[model samples]
Structures are given as C-alpha cells and as structure tokens.
Target: MVVIKNKCISVSYSDPNFVIVVVAAAAVLLSLCVVPVSAAAAKQELKLRFGRNGEFKILQVADMHYANGKTTPCKDVLPSQVHGCSDLNTTAFLHRIISAEKPHLIVFTGDNIVGLDATDAAKSLNAAFAPATASNIPWVAVLGNHDQESTLSREGIMKHIATLKNSLSQVNPLGAHAIDGFGNYDLEIGGVKGTRFENKSVLNLYFLDSGDYSTVPSIPGYGWIKPSQQFWFERSSAKHRREYMSKPEAQKGPAPGLAYFHIPLPEFASFESTNFTGVRQEGISSASVNSGFFTTLVAAGDVKAVFTGHDHINDFCGELTGIQLCYAGGFGYHAYGKAGWKRRARVVEATLEKTEKGSWGAVKSIKTWKRLDDGHLTAVDGQVLWSKKSSGNRRKKQIPIT
Candidate 1:
C-alpha cells in the first residue's frame, strides 16, 4: 500500500510486526512530549508587551543546523575542543544565551536542523528546540533549505513546529489568501499599559518562507519569495496600518515592523565593505532571480529591518533604501563556522519613548548587538537600527566595523 501526505510518500508492506514496532516507538515519544497548549491559552500567553522598564528584547538564533541530538559532531572547531564536541554543545550555547539574555521572545530564523544528518526529523526537531521549549519562552520559526530533506516534508515540519509548547508559529495565515508557502504569518506587539496607545499595536513582526532551491531550470539558484506571498504581505501591512490609524495617536505614525526569513534576498549583494557594519567573510548566497520583495518592503513603508540567516559567516547589518538588512551569524556548533571564532547570536531591543508626563509611549528606537558564546558571553558590534528621533534622516550611520 502507498500513502502520501505533506509531500512525503511511504510504501507499506504487509507485516504485522512493522506496525507494532512503529506504534511502540510513537507511544514512547508521545509519552515524553509536553501537552500541546490550547489555542486560546497560546493566544493570551503569546501577546507581547514591553516590560515596566519600557523594553522588549528579542534573541535571534540563526542556522542552528542541529541533527541527531547529541550525536552530531561539531564542525570547524579547534583541535582541543574537538574531542567531545557534538550537537550538545549547540544546546549548551542556546541555554546559556537564553539564561543570560532573558528575552521576551526568541526567533529561530531557520536552518533549525540538518535534515539529511538527522536520523528522525521529528526527534531532531524536538531535541533542537528542547532548550526553547524547556525554557517555556514564546518562540517562532521559519523553514530553511536543509530542514525538509528528511522523511518529513516542509509542510509536515511546520505543522509539528506549531504544536510544540510555547510556539507561536502557524502553518499559514487564516482565511482564503492562497499564500505561496507555509509559515507566513504576522504577530503584533501591543503598547504599554495605562498609555493612550495601550490597546494599539506598537510593533509588527512578519515571518515568510523564502523557499529552498529554484524550481525553474533557467533560474539556477535559490528560490525567490513568490508574488503571491508579496500580495499577502501587502494586504496584511495595510490592515495593520488601518487599525493603527483608527486611533487618535495615528499622528505618531505607523508602527515599526521587523521581518524574519531563512534566505537572504538579492538586494543583499548591493552592500560593499565600507557601506555595512560587521564582517562579510563570505559571498551573499541569494536567489538568482530578483523577486522585487525588497521593493515591496520599501513600498510598505513600515518594515524598518529584515533579518535572515543563509550565509552563516556573513554577520552584517546594512541599510539600503530605508530598511536595514541583517544576518544573525551562525549559532550552532554542527553548522559551518570559523576555526577560532566563537559562535554568536543577535539581540534586538525596542524601547518605548517617554511621554510629556514621564510615562512610556510608543517605541522610540530599535537597537541590536551580537553576543558571542565565549567565557563571559561577550557582546560586540552594537548599533541602533532605527529611531523615531532620526526618522527624517534615512542615510546609513557610519558605525565602526568590528
């Protein structure tokens, strides 16, 4: 018999013992899994808000490339540390960063697992995300080129991810939008309590699936963000703008937006050494065909920055046409990295502005920096991405390169 679902096909032979062994393994795994949260419970718990100190911190974990749990060997590491290095080292780094940063939300910007190396996609995903699930912090993820090379399809991986504890990821948006890919959704961050904009969405977070390899023979590179996804994004952006404008504080202007995806866009190649901050050791591995998504982002007039994680070693943030494009650097020991360079993650903090009466108002500025997985968990390459005070000047600020 042949069975197919989520783009995965399996052929079953007539064997009673086969079913028994599969059932037994599933039972054991299910017993260990955390109970999935109810939709209403998840909605309430995931509603983001700035702290009393008027700050919302986000930790961006990129290219985890985890596989086979603790068994996967470390890549591109020093000889001294190569003895016992494995995927467990990646887990330890995640735990250390989460504990140190204590971010309100964690964003896994793809390559979460090395599907080819992972013996079981489901098991690998569970192990890869155990730190976030165990930490009980709200998190979201998008797909990468490597995540669907296992038994599970891209759709299957996203569906499983949505069911994980404290996960805000969705398979797709609700309604009949006919989106191009799975895991295209937006999250709103509400304003501070007791403020006039309290009920208003002060920030928007957009997630899109920049797909795997190119399907067309003529296009000999990565897949571009489809036109359908662009249309959906435009509609969503307009809807959020209308809602924000309904209130009197619309004069404060539209809420800032930040987008996350797995692959970098073609526009990433436009920056040179003198133009961008941080290091670009490798070439930009972008789609061969330009999809005009960057132009759409500029047209939307709200997205302040875009974050991606395909070219692991190129950890830079550059401004182009009023939007900041950034790479989160490599975070997993299993993924490719420099020999002596420590693994790192990016931290983004958005602070609310102070009102005339000395209370928190809308978001004043968005700043970001990276933390290395060294002894002190050192922070480096700090810079402001966007600020309402400098809204008029869209030129790139000259930050010293690290």
Candidate 2:
C-alpha cells in the first residue's frame, strides 16, 4: 500500500504500485519546477513608458542587408576603406549609433538581411540584430523584398525575428482578423509612470509588412500593402482612438501615431526637392499599383508620420495633406550606396505635454533628424513633424548637413 502523509508518498515494501506512485510524484515535481521558469519569461516582457524628462526617442535603422557575417564584401565604400570593409562595418555602425543616441526603442525598418547572400538565414539575422539585443533595448522590424530569397519564407523570417532577445516584432497580431502580411502589428508607448495617465497609451506605433514582388502580372514593381492589412490597421487605429478618448484623464485629442514599413508608398513620388528636407537621389521605388494605403493613413487622422526603407539612397521627409512621409537611409555597407555619401539613420523624438500642475501629459510634439555614420556621427536636417502648439502647422527646424 501507498500511504500519503503530510504531502509525502510513503511506499510499503510489499506494494506493487510503489513504482507508479513514485513516477507520478516525479512528474508533479517536474511540472512544479517549470512554473518559475515560465513566470520569469512572463516578467521579461518589455513595457515602454516616458522618462521623467518627458521624452521618448526612437532610432530607425533600415536596410541593413547583412549576409554571411564577416565574409560578405561591402558595396559603394570609399577606396581607402574598401580593403577590409564588410558586414562588420554595418555592425560597428549600429553599435556606434546606439551608443551615441541611447534611444528608448530601436526600429529595424526592413531588408535586415540580403537573403540571397545569406547561406544561413538564422545566423545572418542573429548577427544583424546582435547590437540591439546586446544593448538590452527593445527593438522591432518589418520585412523587405529581398528578405525571403534564401532558406526561409517571409513568414519564417518573421517567426525567427520574434524569437530574438529584446525583439518586439510579432509574426502577426493575434485574433481572427486574418491579416494579409507576416509582421502586421502595433506597439503602444505608455505615458509617464506614477502620473494620472500612466497606463494610458500616449503614442502608437504601427508596423506593416509591405511585401516583396507583385502577384498580379500587370502590376510590375514591388508588392503593395494589401486591402486586408489596411482594414486591420484601420480597426486597430480606431480601437486606440476610442480607448484614449474614453479615459477621464486623457488629454484633448487622439494620441499621435507613427508607422514603419519596408517599401515606400506611391505617394512618395509626389514630393519635390523644394518641399522636402533631405536629398532624394533615386526614383521613388514604390509598387506600380497604388494600393491606397496612404489614403487609409490620411483618413485615419492619427498617424503623424510614416517611415520606410526600400530606396537605399533616398533619405528624405516630405509632407502631404498633413501627414509626413520619411525614409531611413540605407544603414548597411553590404547594400548599394553612393561611394562618397555617408550611410545614415533617422531619429525621432516625441515630447510629452506639460500639464498645468507641472506633470507630463500627452505627446506635445514629434520631431525627427538624421544621423550620418561619419566620424562625428553628424546630426542633420532636424525638423518638427507634428506639434500640438503649432495648431497643425508643422514648423521646419533645419540643421544644415555639413
């Protein structure tokens, strides 16, 4: 007989069930041991909130194009530096920028690896994102055209990214929405802690997978954001808006939103050199078919800016109908770039409004600037994308590129 006393399993010498009870008790103990490990993982989830100084900074690193670790040769680098330049140069730049800016969030806005050159997609992705992971900062990513030319499909790539340390990138949003793309998700930045609006989502970030090649024979360029993806976005945006407005302690209007994707929309071609801040060296490489994603954004009336990457050399920010469209210049040495032009990344800073009682409130202004990978890590073309004080008039704060 097996006797249970004070949570102890006492087995008799003659009992045939002794071994079975012992095995069952071992299984129960093993399951109890697993609970703390699962709880630890749950506790590791990142929560983004404003600092005491009321600022949240985001660093946009785009088109890394990393491949095969240190073996891949760099393109379009100066002749003097070409002897040893490789993907490691890109990694070094990431480390340098992260050190200099110390951003709250790092966004890898796609083409993270050149899939064709990557013999092992997982290894390349690990090296490509090592900086963000090592820094212990929250990071997220979208996908680009060339990311699935290797061992993994687009869905596989997103799933791999979602497993990396400090990665906030999701395979897709949960629920029965049936979104069209892989990395279609959003992250909310909460207000200052200990404030009345601490739990409130003050800033919203939308990430979409602007897909690879066109499926339709007639529409020739890159793939556009699908209708279902747009529908998901609209629903998500509306939900955020409703939550913000319903709160008693919420500020006057809807919280500002920013979007990140891999490919530029067709509307990017509409900006002239005179209207935008940075240089557009290449043609707008948007999909042939205008998928009306820009129209969806404008209609939503919450997203203040959209950041994209596919055109490596075009690092410009232009406004159309109250929405700013911007590009994060190519950040990797493995990707094609101008020999003389320095690789760059974009930095966005959102400042919270100060209440009458001197505490932080909703987002007051959204500003952006570009940082070149030169020796100085030069900051250029600082501009205000949006401002509550301006009353819809976005003022340009230009810092000339030296």
Candidate 3:
C-alpha cells in the first residue's frame, strides 16, 4: 500500500522488504490491460414514448443475408446476377437507410446474416446492425428460417447480438419452455398523458422465431410456430394484462401490438383483400401446416398485424380478416432475389392521438409503407393499414410502473 495526496493505492509485493516495485507495478498494469471490459446489462423493461408530434416510426430491414465472402454469381437467380454478401455496397445501402429514415427503432425481421464461420457471422451481424447502433437507435430482432442454417446456432447468434451496444435482443431462457426457437419475447412502448403522472403502454411488439424447417417427419420445407410457443405467447399476454389492465383506473381493453418473424403463416394464404398496394411476384411460401398461431393472435385480440420476410420477392400487404398481413422486401444482395427487383424495406409510422393537458388519448392509427433503395415510398395498402376504428378499440395510456 502506498499513500499519495491522502489517497491510498494498493500494490502487491511478493517480498516484504522489496526495494524495487517496478516489476510488481508492471504486472498490475498488464493484468488491468488483460481484464475484459464488462458490458452494460440488458434492459429488464424497455421504455419508449411518442415524439413531440405524437408519432413514432419503425424501419424494418429484412433478408439482409450478409456474408463475408466475395460476391458470387447466384446461378439459381440468373446468369448475369450476382450476390452482394461481401460487396461493400451492402454497407452503403444500410447507412443510407439509417440516414434517411432516422427511425426511433430499427427491427431486423430475419436472415440478417449468413456466413460459414462463426466469427464471420458475428462480423456480418455487427455490420448489419452498425447503422442502427451508430445512429443511437436501439435495434431488436427475431430469428428467421435462414438464420440458423449457418454455422452459428440460434442461441449463439443471439449471444453475439447481446454483446452489441444498444441491442435489445432477448432469447428464450434455457429450459423455460418447449418452444424450439430462440429470441421469442415481447416489448412495450409506453406513453405519458400530460403532466398528471398517468402514463401507460401504447403499443406492444412481439418478436418470435418462425423456425427454418419442420421437425415432423412428413412435413417438409418451412417451419411453423409450435403450440408450446403459442402457449408462451398467451402466458406473456396474460401477465402484461394483469400488470396493466387489472388496475382500477386502467382502461378495459387489449393493447395494440405487432408481430414480426421470418416465414409467413399458412393463414396468409387467405389474404385476398383488394387493398394490396405493393408488389407480389412469388406465391406465399408459408408453412405446410397451419399451426393456429394466427388463431392465437386473433383470440388474444392484441396483435393488430403480422410482418414477415422469407418470401423475398413478395413485398405486399393486405387485410386477413381484421388483422393486416404484410411482407418486407429482401434488403440483401446476397439473398435469392429477382435480378432487376429493387431492394426495399418496410416503414411503419404510428400516429399517437394528440391529447389535451391532464388527459391522454389512445393511438389514433398506424400507417405502414415501403421505401425502396431508390428513395421511393408508397403505402403497403392504398388505405390506412390499421385504424383505431377498425380495431374497434383505442389504446389508452399504460400506467408507468412506479
């Protein structure tokens, strides 16, 4: 121990009568350098509020499919076509979106990366989420069909993501449930009503792992959300309801929410609404078996819409019953996409009701659209995708947990 200016600094000496302490000091310095820096713990509850103008925007980038290898000709797509996995242009495209949109939150739907080596996969994901992280925007994700196809397992990929700054990704805890997927969790965005101290959640976001392939012997191709996962969703919803809706002053209703995954559900086949605004070339490549996950959402009455990414060429959205079904275009050049097809992303702008002093109104509506890489923007549906009126309920302020 050494005292300087009334401050004591501890120093370890192997010999009690040591005349020279340089070697010990050097060892201490080396130890300090070798120690790993601890990361900030993940949030237990994420908080979000509307902007000054009562609006929040979310940019959804899907099918990034980044890889660390050199660009190669996708023989499956076309003779003249090339994949953009290792192309520098992929980084430029993502940076442009971050600059243009400046979204409050960026959501990567799935297939954010695909690489052979685990280290390369992590590097690719770091590049993919770089835009959002650099802009100080928190990003969340769900696992897709192609995500686990690489050398990295779903848990391993999520663990890598957790190391990133400003990452809000959460996967299923080990041995918690029978669900076969990772990163299945929900988050809520709260809004405060004036200065009266009455605040509550206005929107909920659900991120689920729509698995890559079916485990059943007979079924092939796409995977479906398992019944255990559905049960997990129900339990989560119930807990949220008990936390907020059970309050004496709480409004009696379901909180409006949105679900994002990789593969489209089988029920998306019934999406024949005439309100389609975007393009759809390939048929919906949904799971072979209807897992009733859509039915679970409908019964829960919280999920207002579902967005997916597996079908790269399909970027259209339409009403499936009362809920909206939408697809974001493939954002990666590495993915299997039409040669001339424009790479695009989906933008969801939520409109919060303008509330008077001392009182708050629910979410007025949510408008969704697609923005192509060329900067062109158009609504997913010509009409409003989801309105408070259409939902038959208004989401009131969720009381802040004091």
Candidate 4:
C-alpha cells in the first residue's frame, strides 16, 4: 500500500513483517515482484490466474432468440407472436464479441431461436453464427427448453442442427459437431505461453448439457435430456477426462475437464429445479442431484470450471465445490430490461486464458457496446473480475463431497 499526505510518501509490503516507506521528491514508483516458485512447489499446486496474455479464447453466447421462420415486416418481433427474442441489435453485438475477442471456441448456450414461432431455429442459428462463420472460428452448441419444447419435433430438432451445420460448412471445412448424447462435446486448445513461465500450454474444453428436465415428457411442453442420453452422458463425460490426460498437450489441472452447459447443475439449482444430480438435473437430464450419475462425472478429475446460462438474468460466476459456475447474463429477450447507464440487460463476454505455463484463468467481463451507439470494440468501462492462480494451481481438485 502507498500513501502520500502532509509530508511523506509511504510504501508497504505484505510480507511476514514488512511496511516500509520510500520517499521520492521526483516521483518514484515501487513495483512488487512476486517471486517465482520452485519446481517442487509448482508440482504441489498449479497456479492458474486471469491474465491478458493467453493461448486461446472460448466465447459463450446465450439466448439469441432469432425469429427464424417469421417475417418481421417492421422492427420488433413480439414475444406473444413468437415467444422468442427478435435478435434485434444482438447480431452486431455478437459480431463485435467475435471480432474483438477472436475466440477459438464459441458455445451458444441454447434458446437459440424463439422456437415457438414458425421461423426455423436452424435458420436463426445460422444468422446468429454468421460472425463466427465469417471469422472461421469453431463452435459447439446446445439447445434450451424453448428449443426442444417448441413447435419443432424430434426430427425437426435434428434437422435444425443439421441445417446449421450445413451452413457452417461453407466457412469451416472441419464443420460443426452437435455434441452427442448429453450435449457433451470436447475440444483442445494449445500453444498458449505462460505469463510468468517460459513454456507454452493448451486447454481442453467440454460443454456439458444438463438439459432441461423440469417438465415431464408426458406433458409434451419442454426439452428433456432423456434417460438414455443421461446414461451415455455419465459414461462419456468420464471418458473425456480420462482421454484428456493422455494428451501430452493438456495443461496440468483437475481431471474433470472444463465444461459449459445450459440450465444449472444439481448443486447450483434452485429448490424448484433441484434434483441433486439425478432425474432433476438429468431427467430430460438424469435424476442427477444426489444420484451417482452426477457424482461420477465430477469425480472424473480434470473438471475445472463449469460455465452456464439458463437463469436468463444476470452474468454470474460463483464457485460450487471446486468447480466455478459462470452464468453469461441474459443475451436475449430482456422484455423487462433496462440498460443501467451501463446497460445491465446486455450480453457477457467471457474468456478462459491459459498463461505461458499450463495454468488456467477465468474472466467475467461486461460490455456496454453499441456499434450503432459507439464504434470501438473495447469492453464497457474496461474492468473485469479475474480468478487468482497459485504458483502452480492447475485446477486439478477432484469433485463431489460424497
């Protein structure tokens, strides 16, 4: 800490016992140098903290509510007419997130199109993905309750996903993947340099689909993850973490691997949506609450942070057990929204950066961007909340209290 007042400038350091004052008549600055840890210390805990320098970027966009099949002769697409967001003013914002962030992976966390309308969620998804396609960035997407429960059928859903993939082909030859079973998909990111260290590293990302299971299948109103998919999800999620370990490039971290999903997990779910990890979280999910299915997945080892969207409200990121749950504020249908001078009802631009060494860091950022309002690509006010990393904290902590 530094203080300058009546007659002095003081400098203080938070070491075992250290508070020193350095006076500078000509203006002097003190820099705190964090000593690098020894290799042995590094091995004990992997240090992963938020840093500007990183190898790749993973951008998550939620609830675009594109009016796919409907024709909006004028401007607004009424929710009463389609019960979905109009994607108004969001296209440019989406493009801006891509253009400025240049993320390596993009995850659309469901509610992609206002599925209630005749407009195909697939076409709306295409429009939403236009910027990603243009940037040649790879992406993996999952569906929301609105997507599964909408007028579209199972076949319709499959067709919609396929349609989006087809359109993406024009941009990326590797194309897109719809994440089999539990909306669970994996990708690897490498070539990141450690901020403090000299070695380059990589990151493995997974999108866990804790599909909406609130509504009963018999009711025929919402998307359910289904038992079979839940079964496969458990088996496969574990498989991914094990597979991640084999990768020589995978950063040193927890084995569960990093994942993003729509809808909150059992532990994070509210009472009404609570199921521990069993049928509630897994029903269309798996009965995930206190059940074995949810336990087994978190136990996989490499699981670091789980970013999600479904609350359709604020951009929240909190720690659940060892895993971090990040909610990218509502990106669609802010019907009762007002931009608080800062535009609180806006989109969130999140990033997971890996330092020179193999440490992982997460950042929650807000942007009051208006290409039509303002032209620069900078994030609003230029401030963010970043996670702190120890000397070698690789986020390798095992999960599940049981």
The candidate that wins on TM-score is 2
Higher-TM-score candidate among 2 and 4? Answer: 2
Tens-digit lDDT string for candidate 4 (31-136): 2112333332221132222234533345677766555422432123343434433454566567766666555556777666656653555566566667766776
Off by over 4 Å in 1: 1-45, 392-402
- Better by lDDT, candidate 2 or 1: 2
Sort the candidates on lDDT, descending order: 2, 1, 3, 4
The local distance difference test score of model 1 is 0.81
What stretches of model 4 exceed 4 Å from their correct place?
A: 1-54, 68-86, 149-151, 162-182, 190-201, 213-234, 237-256, 269-294, 333-402
Clashing pairs in model 3, backbone N/Cα/C closer than 3 A:
84-333, 199-398, 199-399, 200-397, 200-398, 200-399, 201-398
Q: Which lDDT tens digits does candidate 1 get at residues 316-343?
A: 9999988999999999999999999889
Instruction: Go through the candidates in order and give each one's C-alpha lDDT.
Output: 0.81, 0.83, 0.66, 0.41
Q: What does candidate 2 score on TM?
A: 0.87
Best by lDDT: 2
Judging by TM-score, tell me the better candidate of 2 and 3: 2
TM-score of each: 0.87, 0.87, 0.79, 0.56
Residue-level lDDT of model 2, residues 221-263, one tens digit each, is: 7888875566667767887888888857755678999999999
Candidate 2 runs further than 4 Å off: 1-45, 391-402
lDDT (C-alpha) at residue 389 in model 1 = 78
lDDT value for model 4? 0.41
